[model samples]
Target chain A: MKKLINGADTVLEESLDGFAAAHADILLLGAERKFVRRRTLKPGKVGLLSGGGSGHEPLHAGFVGRGMLDAACPGQVFTSPTPDQIIEAAEAVDTGAGVLFIVKNYEGDVMNFTMAAEMTGREVASVVTNDDVAVERSTYTTGRRGVAGTLIVEKMVGAAAEIGMPLAALKALGDEINRRTRSMGVALLPCTVPAAGRPNFTLADDEMEMGVGIHGEPGRRRVRLASADAIAEELVGAILKDLAPEPGSEVLLLVNGFGATPLIELYLMVNSAKRILEGAGITAARFLTGSYVTSLDMAGVSITVSVLDGQAKELWDAPVHTAALRWGT
Target chain B: MKKLINGADTVLEESLDGFAAAHADILLLGAERKFVRRRTLKPGKVGLLSGGGSGHEPLHAGFVGRGMLDAACPGQVFTSPTPDQIIEAAEAVDTGAGVLFIVKNYEGDVMNFTMAAEMTGREVASVVTNDDVAVERSTYTTGRRGVAGTLIVEKMVGAAAEIGMPLAALKALGDEINRRTRSMGVALLPCTVPAAGRPNFTLADDEMEMGVGIHGEPGRRRVRLASADAIAEELVGAILKDLAPEPGSEVLLLVNGFGATPLIELYLMVNSAKRILEGAGITAARFLTGSYVTSLDMAGVSITVSVLDGQAKELWDAPVHTAALRWGT
Candidate 1:
């Protein structure tokens, strides 16, 4: 595989080193690389921490800063971090209020984060996200695998936590956000993991894997490539089927890239999906388009639709200062 | 040629529709998609305007908003915008303080922007960027192509314009930034222009084009793929050779992606290049990483190093709110 790394085994540490150096102004590295935490801690504010495999960057790590995650522990590519890593991160970010873990639904991630929640000594709680509607049970997950929708979950709840929400309330808020969100992805090409040195799956030039997961796992089906409008209809249709938001309800639409797709294509997808949502009498009032959650170098796109209430809409618009997502600060 | 676009013919307008919808709070689309202008234009601020082909997104259009370009005109993918479009954009953004055009050094872009400057009624000036150290004379240009370094120029000068720097002084500051910066890119795989419906060039599995242009134009040479560290050395080495910054000088380093390269690889290149800069006794004091300027779906990265004086460094850190870049609000 033609990847830009010194070696597969060292990709995580090297990239972490670069990350730490580049963003030194905003964050700090934990001892032994257990996690990355904000440089400045806020007293009595609940700590918000999340993590998973290293490949889907700007998710857990990039979301760490003023109004988002407080700490993030990154494991090797497509592998879960150990419980010890999560424990250390919790300790580093805790400000006496408590620590809240944002765990994805993958079995390894849920288990490791749960172990850390148990092992840590504090008022700790957790919110496990399973917002990917692509699968009920997948290769590495027991239920729907958390994908791009996890970004929305982290963002809205992180804003509430920043406003001094109690640990229990923050956990509840996170769960509520996750319950209202759904995502589906389509892959034009499989990503090559640094360690694997080969694509995990293959797609013919004229085919696409609909409902694809972030780690190149098998999706719902492989089908002949179609126009952006047809793909947008399928993705939004499945989401609307599951979500069933009332007519005229407002929603936030996210057109996310899976590493190798261009931003223009993501924007084009946004236009197509927004039109589809309008035709269904659902107004896509808010929008974000970019590669926030990504697989290594996969050529694909994920559509995330989140039904928003007054509180969620306000929190979503609140100021956030992270490496990946920033606004009003 | 698997892409998420409805049709190559409508890609420009469709993407612009999505972009305008996604960022309505910050920018306004001009009549018939001629340009995107800041929603609340400053009355007396020296209006900053830039534009070119549409494919290298987040460049001209994404950079439009507060503390940056007051307006950006977008043309069809990989083709220059017409002179009338530029003239109209200039008229919309120009306040009492006049307007300054930031043009990339392309044959079409330069010729068209020059025509607009001559045709406009108000006082006008420009800083034509030609910072690519890849080739002295290359395809589509009479001199070095303005690549990723153009972002640095727009940012630093945009910051100055925000503080109400006059049109003439802003043009001079932009030229100064261009003089101090140099860039080089390496493309692992060629990009397919949607309109062309084919890859612009081809490379063997184990080869890369060094110093490749943003449009997939020929670079200095094609060589066997090398490790990230070795590749970083070659790119940064060429920049250092041409720039020849003082041993103790500080710089702002930008590692930019060519649409498809992953973020981890960009950070790895950052670490590699930072170490090389330190070895040369030069300091890389500021950093930005991502695919700001891109060649639609090309899997590659470019390294841009700009020497920063005290004023330039301070301006780089100033508050600027745009769809793509935001900080310190």
Candidate 2:
């Protein structure tokens, strides 16, 4: 596999250094290494924290800014952040209002974030996002792993905290948002980790994987590559069926691309989704089509939908500032 | 050439549908075909509008939340949004406070945004972010095209706008930020555009391209693979020499990965950047290491540095909310 750096070992640290130099507005703190909120916390506003592995760029860290997260702990490539690191981050960003940990539904993430929250002496509330609809829950594991839905939960909960909403209310709001969201993804190609210097999984020239995870984990199944529209139909169908948005109710659509999928493909997929939704008599009120959340170098796409109510819509409309998401002046 | 979609023709539309369904809190404004600020417009706050082609995720659109952009027009993959689309977005989001266009320094983007601004027939302030150090400036073009530095400019300017800063001041601030910022990137493998279904360029197994653009464009040169330390040193050397942040001056660092780079590799590069900066006596007050701005599936990294003074630092610290970035309460 081809890569740009001199060696694989030093990629993450060097990238962090570059990120710091480029956006001096944010602070990097903790020996364990965390992206801490730059603002001096107001005494009573709750602090929000989230994190995961490093390869999913802008997810945990990029989301650290106004109206979102206070801090984000990053782990090694495709590996969950250590409990010690999350604990350090939690302590550093926490103020009197407490901290909310937005944990994705992955086993490693859930476990690590849970451990860190438990270890924190201060009051902390946690919300787990399990919006991916591709996987079915078995007795052995949680239903579906969180994909892009974590972003909505983080934003909604962060906005509540920003306005001084109490911890219980914020948690409740997050849970509601989580309950209203669903996602499903398909992968075109397996990404090669720099350390491994090879594709994670081999694919025949015309093959693709459906319901793939962000870290090259196996998804529902492998299948022949299809047209963008058909793949989108499959993914969107799964998400819509899982979400089952109330008829005529507004919804938020997110057509995300895995790392390698081109924008052309992503746009085509978005077009397909519009047709599919319209055919079902579902009205999409807002659309965010891009690679918001991504798997490293995985050529694929994911569809996410959230049923919106007045409160949820208002929270979603709230102003936010972070490395990754910024809007609404 | 492997991809997950069923067909190329319907990616964008399908993706949009999913995005709208997933993010109902943000209004899609289907008839308008633009993402409007979900919040009721402040009576006299200037609307910030930005947009470009589809591939650059979390960019023009993701930044359209709170405290950043009011609206964004998304075009086809890697292509500039049409002038009509941008004009429509500008008109829809305008609340009598005028609109500002924060445009990256690409030829197509500059032309399209410029046309849109001109057609608005309203008082519109515009700032072009041109901070990539890889290309040199001449009378012929605006020098290096804007890369990741666009994100910083957007955040700072967005924060200013959120606080009701006048359009003139916001434009000045954006221009000043652009002046102090610089970026340079190298690529390991050329990314494949979905429609093309092939890599943009051919690379020998051991070769790398330097100074790559986000659209899979050719870079300054192609060279043999080097060590992470060497690559960091070279990229930093170019950027530092170009911007030359003075000794003891505070700076922001961003070691961004073009999609496909692993975190471990980024971390190693970050360490190398620190060493280089320390040797130069430059203080890195804040650091971000991740893939903030990304080319589709290119395997490479870019380094960015913003020289910061007290005011820039404060503005940077301000809270923001959007799809890609969120922080301070």
Give the range where candidate 2 chain B is weakest over 10 consecutive residues by summed lDDT: B29-38
* TM-scores for all predictions: 0.99, 0.72
Q: Write the per-residue lDDT of candidate 1 for residues A1-329, one digit (tens) a residue.
A: 89888999888888888888899988988998889998998999999999999888777898999888999999989999999999999989888999999999999999999899898877899998888888899999898899998989889988998889999999899999999999999999999998788899999989999999999888899999999999999999999999999999999999999999999999899999999999999988899999999998999999999998899899999999888988878
Q: How accurate is candidate 2 locally (lDDT)?
A: 0.75
lDDT of 1 at A190: 94
Retained true contacts (fraction), each candidate: 0.68, 0.47
Local accuracy by lDDT, each model: 0.92, 0.75
Candidate 2: regions farther than 4 A off: A1-28, A34-49, A64-66, A70-75, A80-101, A108-126, A137-142, A162-172, A262-268, A287-292, A327-329, B3-183, B213-220, B242-278, B281-296, B304-329
lDDT string for model 2 (B1-329, tens) is 66545545554555555444444464464454554443445657788887777766656666776667788787776778888888888787778878889888777888988988888798899989888777665222466788888888887788888889878888888899999998888888777666887887888988888777877677678898787778878888988898888788888777777765654456557777778888888877766665667766677888888898998888777876665566664
DockQ of each: 0.80, 0.29
